[model samples]
Target: MPALVRAGTAQQWPQALAVPGGVARLSLGPAAERPVVHAGDIPVLVLGDAIEWTAIVGIPLAAPVGEAEVTVQAAPTAPARRVAYRVAAKQYREQRLTVAPRTVDLAPEDLARHERERAHQQHVMATFSTPLPEGLQMRQPVPGRRSSSFGLRRVFNGQARNPHSGMDIAAATGTPVAAPLAGRVIDVGDYFFNGGTVWLDHGGGLLSMYCHLSRMDCQVGDVLRTGDAFCRVGATGRVTGPHLHWGVMLNRTMVDPALFLPA
Candidate 1:
């Protein structure tokens, strides 16, 4: 299992995980309304009622393993308060595979397509919505054996690639994938690497993505509640087989999806 570090007064979903590319939830006592918290310049999610407010911080993968902070502004007129957090180093294992040459070395046209998709997906993942969700607990989008591949440094055809950013669930082709939380469809497209993908904006810098889908039932701007079937699993993109690449993004950074999964 991947090591996790957590801190906070929150009974559920605590504030800080010192691990690089982890999440921190900060509790800001009592508020008239939801406060605005910034993890750097990006707005973090503030969730609460007329009572306490909490900020969900997404620690980046590149963040140095040490102390970090976020700024919280209770109201528009109020000054921002800096809240301290810690980030610890977590080592990920390396995996090597021998795949087809084409999969390892992309053609010029494929590379161009990937660049465009990356830009568009980045915008979609950065979406911040009003009326933040109350909690981070999420239902499994599909029923299958969860592969602990998150953060695995992958080498394909002797070439080092980026660490895996999402959790992979091994499932059969055409397996249904459901929305883990209420969200609006912000992006749906076919890409070079991700294949058919769907991005959901779940308000307040909390987003979810489903990739390598065989079919997409939801379109952009569509609203879906938890358990709504939005797509079917497939081996569309560059994949070994049919499975769902589920990702959770907080503050525009991809954190471990397992953090949001039910215990």
Candidate 2:
């Protein structure tokens, strides 16, 4: 697919919520589709009628079944599809669910300022050109059932918030966090939601993040081998317990980690 096209703000997604994964997909039959991720985000562009794309954001697993809005804007030439989704949160054997306390309070502007962060994330997608590291492999940083459902809506401490940005691996405090792949550390610090976070640049615009670390080992610019000790997982930012929150961004778009691993 081409990487650029006439971009426009899609006014809305009327039926975007009915899909199983809270995602809507559009498959362009047989034409090359151009995609632009705003800053450091990935833009999922489906090309060809047989290639429908899926758009999904996670909702809280504990949330009572409900409805939410999705914003979309595209043209007939670049038409968009809307899908509504039904959600049910499951707990026990494999996973658990609950509310996470906020690490801090955000004023309206402090929260809205993230649009720039989101846009910048998308823009990073346009510059992807690095190769993945050699001899790079990964083991689960923490061992536990998933907690925060990926792409789900979340209400932190009673205030509505953005969808969960990463996958939650519920482990005990100080669970060793390892590098999924070999890469140079580019960013390491506390984020608004990702407390004590670190970003690994596995070539190109591909990156992975480890958050809520109770103990951070490597610093920015450190080159690491796969499975290298990166940090110690914990519920540092806002949480009920110690767990490792792992996030991966491919060309800046957040894709399921399972896609890159054995299920």
Candidate 3:
């Protein structure tokens, strides 16, 4: 089957109830054939048959829970069409954790190193490649129980920290992790928080990241297909045990990885 034909049959758009810090899959239908869509200013992934297209929208954690809109342009001379979607409210659980004080508070040198790492990651997350992804359905990178820690507002040692941005899968150290979809490896690095991380660009603004790996098998610019082993799970970062931190990025925002799981 052709790539677009296969993608059209495999991908199903989620309903239009956009939850904060979540994802909203909107269908443009036949009218949007060959459309270029954007959620706000950020371009969204559009995939489907010749008659219809679907837009995968990433709702920011801070996005207002209400009506939201996306712009679609079918051609260069065609007028942009605004498609509105509803953003529903979702309440994520709060978690309080007590860890080593130094982990929360870094020294001057550690802080500087962290700052540099953050800048580099920000650039990686902002990558928007041409040729949108064929499909968004993803296979789990490793076989394990998923931790219900995603989107959890965490308070560490009486200090508020950012919400958990990735889905944590508990696995044994050195467990092989596979690629969730076909994509090119865009970034690979070890950082202060995410050790042995690999980021894949699944075309357009769709990206996925695997962090805290015990080993990396692929290098930057490597093309990986679905189910291909690319890394190994481990307790490499600031974590309690061996696990895989899998993140799905859309339009530069880290949305819930569960959204891409097969229904």
Candidate 4:
């Protein structure tokens, strides 16, 4: 089993950016044990312990620019209390691309495949485990120029779709991708939109995903340390070129991956 983080000395928390698609770190005060926290119905990642507890929340990109609250309970039978925070608006740039018409408008078979993949991926994303003892900071998985930023409103073939939910790193085909943090490989598969994909559970409702890979070296249940090479970059899915789509998810919401890295 992974070690538990010492209450106040070891962990390096992610920067708190209280905006849509950002992270909000709220203090939960001191308690005898780690508090149970939730943002609406989604379980949240809580760190620290008796000395001090903190709730790390991932604000969704579509969240309104206003106040939000989380419910916290020190114990199972303890009354839940609300902690409120503000989510500011952020304007991300837009990107337009011309991809194959087939990818933009999927056929019936492809649509069905996509729906199945989506359901499976959702289950994978919902995984939560014991909180990792190590710090929350992460290194870059693959060194390269950032081809695309997160939250970019994307338009393909003149049809607008969901905002870009991850950072795309420009790397050559077969460029090795590393694990940004120590984690357990929870899922690995080829998908309709994400292509060759790998999901890593970093524990405590924190997860990271790598997509558009040429190859995957790790399998489900593989434990990897930080900087372990686990895959290679590629243009496997509905992409214009070879790149890595790196996503960091907290509490089942995809937030800005940059918040976990050094500035």
Candidate 5:
């Protein structure tokens, strides 16, 4: 297959939902070449060819519920233009959970370790590689009940924390976790918060993450086809039970993973 799939229509993979923690698919008009688009400072994924191009931008959950824009440069020498879009507000329900006190209130050494791991993971999320020919639509990485939804305001042990950023699937510890889309393994590590994490680069600033695995079967630089098993669900991270935490990221922003899945 070709490295880049030509997006010949306005309707592309990943349904567009322009709310915070959602996606905005903007048309870049017909260009002789693919236009370069950036949501704020980070580059976004631009698909299509010389005919019609579209910019798929991932809006942060913390984004203001109002106007937003992306910079579009039609060509190398062309002047950049701002394409505006609206980001509607979204209200996510609050979730209260009780976990180990140590996990919530980390020790000094654990805090430092988490900080280092967070930095490395941020770098991994910024990866942008060649576009995938297999396209952007994805399959669920694991088979189970949806135990948690994205963007939930989580209160851990009565202490407020960041909103949940991924979808959690309730599954057995040894149940296999597969690749949602064709991708190259970009990062894998056992961390303080996410333990047994794996990040996959789907190219063009699009990536997917799987966390809390009992086992990781792939390493960095390993390429996997859609549906290929790469890990197993587990309760390796800070959690009350075994599950698969799956996240989809675009342009360095973590978006709702359900946007890439079909109903």
Candidate 6:
């Protein structure tokens, strides 16, 4: 996908595009609001409640079938963002998505085997060799090194579980967590597994999540500036350490963080 909303004007709002590609880029003019779809004609889905200035959109692509008109709009978001997207689904059609969730608990030897398989999954995610979203700025939501690597085959004691969904950055208890980009804070909760959490809506189909927080600073519908504090890092939920489990949902699929960050 193209990046930075065309790179003109003073400010930009996040443009959402739901087409093919892991990262969708748009150049909405600085302070530009209600940007329209610019990708000529194609097939894409614009999610609601996600369009705003200076946002990141996570897109999921359906296997393209011949010709289709891609529609983009904003209304309600299941963390939706939409604008424009690049056309690449025509050539990349083999989507044998491997979903091995371990299915059950296992003995130590079996767990080791699972870990090996899980490592292979991570290799697959990194196999695409795609570049990061152009014009993206990598600012830490909270200062810390990585506590958990992406796609680590996590075993609780001796039982294997699903690979880690998001990247975990090590931080201290009560460390303030900020919005990495501008967006509306839409969801906040203390779920059974995520501990304290806050979901930020970047305009046009991109949504970000910060989990295992000690506190939530913004309520739903609260607009936040990039780097604005939304919560604090904590060891809540199911955790082996205190860290921020930061995740970006591009059209619902959880891609790698390195897909957006500088290499």
Q: Write the per-residue lDDT of candidate 5 for residues 80-141, one digit (tens) a residue.
A: 98888888889999999999899999999999999999889878887888864457888899
Candidates ranked, most accurate by lDDT first: 4, 5, 1, 3, 6, 2
Q: Give the per-residue lDDT of model 1 (tens digit) for 180-255.
A: 9999999999988888999998888889999999999988999998999999999888887789999989999988
Ranking by TM-score: 5, 4, 1, 3, 2, 6
Per-candidate count of clashing residue pairs (backbone under 3 Å)? 4, 51, 0, 0, 0, 38
List TM-score per model, in order: 0.91, 0.56, 0.89, 0.94, 0.95, 0.54
Q: List the residue pairs that clash in candidate 3.
A: none
| Candidate 3 residue-wise lDDT, 183-250, digit = tens | 99999888777878999998888889999899999999999999999999988866777899999888
Return the TM-score for candidate 1, rounded to 2 decimals.
Answer: 0.91
RMSD in order of candidates: 3.6, 10.1, 4.8, 4.8, 4.5, 11.7
Q: What is the C-alpha lDDT of each candidate?
A: 0.82, 0.53, 0.81, 0.89, 0.88, 0.54
* Residues 15-132 of candidate 4: C-alpha lDDT, one tens digit per residue: 7788889988887779998898988888998878799988888999999987788888999899998888877789999999998898889999999999999999999998989855
lDDT (Cα, 0-100) at 177 in candidate 6: 86
Using lDDT as the measure, the top candidate is 4
lDDT of 5 at 121: 87
Determine which window of 10 residues in candidate 3 has minimal summed lDDT: 1-10
Instruction: Name the lDDT value of residue 61 in candidate 3.
Output: 83
